[model samples]
Target: MHPSTLLQLALMGLFVASIPLTMVWLSADANKYRKLVWVMAFLTFDLIVFGGFTRLTDSGLGCPDWPGCYGAANPFIAHEQIAAAEALMPTGPVTKVKAWIEMIHRYLAMGIGVLIMALMFQSVRQWRKTHQQAFAPALPVALFLFVCVQGAFGAWTVTLKLQPVIVTIHLLLGMGLLAMLVWLGGREDYLLHPPAPSRDLAGLRALRTLALLAAIVVVLQIALGGWVSTNYATLACDEFPLCDGKFIPEMDFEHGFTLWRELGKTAAGHYLQFSALVAIHWVHRNFAMIVALVLGLAAWRAARQPALRKTAKLIAAVLLAQLFTGIATVFFDFPLAIAVLHNAGAALLVLLVTMLNYKVKHLLDVSQRTPANADLPANSYR
Candidate 1:
């Protein structure tokens, strides 16, 4: 990397780090490690949003490669190569805007990696002092490993030509990272305010089951959305509430749902047909309806529980936002803004679900509940 490029990378890294650092310093709980975790969690959410922007703006392939764009640390150094690629394919995915978007996403991701490293360091210090491993340093260690895997999939997302399955996994992994960080943050928050007793012992168990159901369905929806994007099928059906103006418009499920092949390719390896794209879009559209109903019902049930109302309402609100953004994407021809919001909404949903699951799980463990709220137990956040 050139001196200037390296300087840019360093400056960007510092700028990204500063956001959370300020939050940590200014928090009411300053000097508390939990504050640091909350800052990381907030920034993780921002990273998820920026990631959506990168994908929506067609920047996933902006660098034309991974880790470093065009074998350089920053786009400034790789400008010439990016220009050449764009010139060869004018409307292709490697323009200057896309490059910036991609690089910015990478920078944010790197910042997160650094923060998680800091978290691990803090956890190790705490664990050594306490000499107990209940809330072991291994939690941070696991997160570190997970993000590295996510970075690998991020690379493959570009290098492998955005293969649907890989891209889909990449999307899910990003969400997984956010959810994990949220859980870590939730642990800290829960530590401050003990865990509430399960509203109904059986209902509490059912909550876990409902959350799991929500997760599986959301994953399926996201995967379907990825398939739609990878195949360039956003406009496959212009009219929503119905596909191409019918209960079921023409489709090529065999081609659309064919799992193991390059992106934009049919099962047998030919260029994908429009109907196949329609099939992909259509399935995601319809499946979303079922997912929304299930999740809405789950959140409503959660709301009925005195301990879970606030989060349940939050989950419900985000789900509605997701539905709106999703419908807007189709009615509005998949504008970049709506598309990004849709992705962000999906990430938010995943995080909320994970927190709900984690919280309820702790409630089930009676010993860990907090003392301030004696009725509830403190989950071990050591």
Candidate 2:
């Protein structure tokens, strides 16, 4: 009966529908595996960025309720209640505009969930007929489960009142989902047939490890970055290479690392001190240097690979974009566009590294003996 409640149900309905709609679109080429994977990959990236937009804009709690705006289908229907909340606390996070942003983020997430499910289903169907062990649907199934868990984190992210640890974990999980999807998509693209061992599998192995480490560094940086954003600590250090005009500003590690507290609280229920905010920002900034060095090395190695040259160059370009965005956030006072893109760049880096890893290592141990995958198969129809 409440407007906010209605809003939640409507959004859930839209989320459910996006799955079937994506399936319908893919029906045109039920066999275009690589193309479908790329399409879904792009959509997942969009979801990540839009999600960043939702959080950075302080709309994560736009409705202050799960699934909708005061039980209504749209903000318009809940305008009276939202306006009342805003009037009570002007400049708070519960305005109608924010509620819409958060709800839209949810809708987009659900859509991506549907697309992955479809990819998994199709992989199963194709694998059955072709006996292609590569696209056997295991990873997709795993990702389907992972997305369910990610949804739970999304709920907790709000229901837990945006606890820093919970929010940071939620951001990591979302990026994790993106990495999984990108890996699957890349595997689907590369493993039409089992790949022959590279002339130097050892080099590939080293690169794989390097890529994984590169991704790990980026994720940690991203988590720190998320902490900074979620707790409104971006401006804790306004200068480029220093905080409060000093390289090592005063910092409170105890409060900053107090994992179980809400957005701006200490473990003992006290308001968070400014030093803690400085610590969060400082750690993230420092990690950026390490990430840059590792990514630079990984990109250089990838560039040397004949097949991976383009992807390697992409890695370099994205790093440049990411670096520019990060600095811009500080010098430019964290403009919404740059902040959102900075987050998006991290997601992109994750996707690229995951895809690169998959291409190099997703070899299937297939003895299927199918004429399709033989020495000179009838066609590369897979």
Candidate 3:
């Protein structure tokens, strides 16, 4: 990529990011910082969904280069190169349409980077002006670093030729970034309006544990799903209730779980077998049941608490939708829209769990601080 191309892409990101920044500045809200963080979180969610679209459409290698399309800022500027590639392999990955999709995804990612930078800047300014530690600058600084790392993985996704591990980590890092932003936003909301004391402090603590466990299970399930997607194994089995119409089918776990191999080959460099793909799909399919059960139990427990009922309902609904979409992907042969929604559903679950975790923590803190609870032993809440 040329210096000129880098500058142009940076300028484009700035232009795109400015739209939301302008809205934040123009709003009458007292806390522009909080509003900006929430907006970034929303946009990050959008980026995750669009990224799934890019992957599902096989646009990951549309440019065959990093940070630019064929060493140019946009697809139009690299039309000649793209056209040549497409001409060489008309049905391959380098079509003009894919170039556009790939570039647009990059542009959105860069815009998010710019917004996070703005957040860091504002945090520093707020701390300096108010001399208050409440406006901590550490998280914004951490976010800046995380996004840089995420950007590096994005580049590797293209340069490494869609290596399964790199692509899957890229997906996980994007979701992790969203989780951090939601946690930050929730913190801001809590500081603005602290929650009331809870009568059942022990229950709240248990709920927090459950929510965290659910989040872990969801992350694992997502990793399995990513492996399936990156390895192009969605249709390996082609049956839902049982793989290949049997309770157990021939599988190659050793080959399937080889982490450092290329996209569709085992560590020994042999072409990945159908049994390996079946193993990949089968594990993801079975894990979905575990995730559904754990998340459902958490939702049922959470719904009994008035403060958490609404978010609990949301959790339950998304879990059901995820189940439907996960099965639909198999039954419908992985339609683009439903497949993308499956990814989005995973993101939504991450957000909800993070939010629930934050809320429970907040309630626990309130319970600890109340005068009525002062007489109780520290472990009494447990």
**Candidate number achieving the greatest lDDT relative to the actual structure:** 3
Candidate 1 residue runs with Cα over 4 Å from true position: 1-15, 22-28, 132-135, 196-199, 367-382
For model 3, the superposed segments whose C-alpha errors exceed 4 Å read 374-382
lDDT at residue 76 of model 2 (Cα atoms): 84
lDDT tens digits, residue span 157-201, model 2: 888877778888888998888887787767666655445433444
Among these predictions, the greatest TM-score belongs to 3
Worst 10 residues of 1 by lDDT: 373-382
lDDT of 3 by residue, 173-240 (tens): 99999999998999888888876666677777888899889989989998999999999999998877
How much is 96 displaced in model 3, in angstroms?
0.6
Give model 2's clash tally: 16
Model 1 TM-score, 2 decimals: 0.88
State which candidate, 1 or 3, has the greater lDDT. 3
Clashes per candidate (backbone, < 3 Å): 6, 16, 0
lDDT of each: 0.80, 0.79, 0.91
RMSD of each: 3.9, 4.7, 2.6
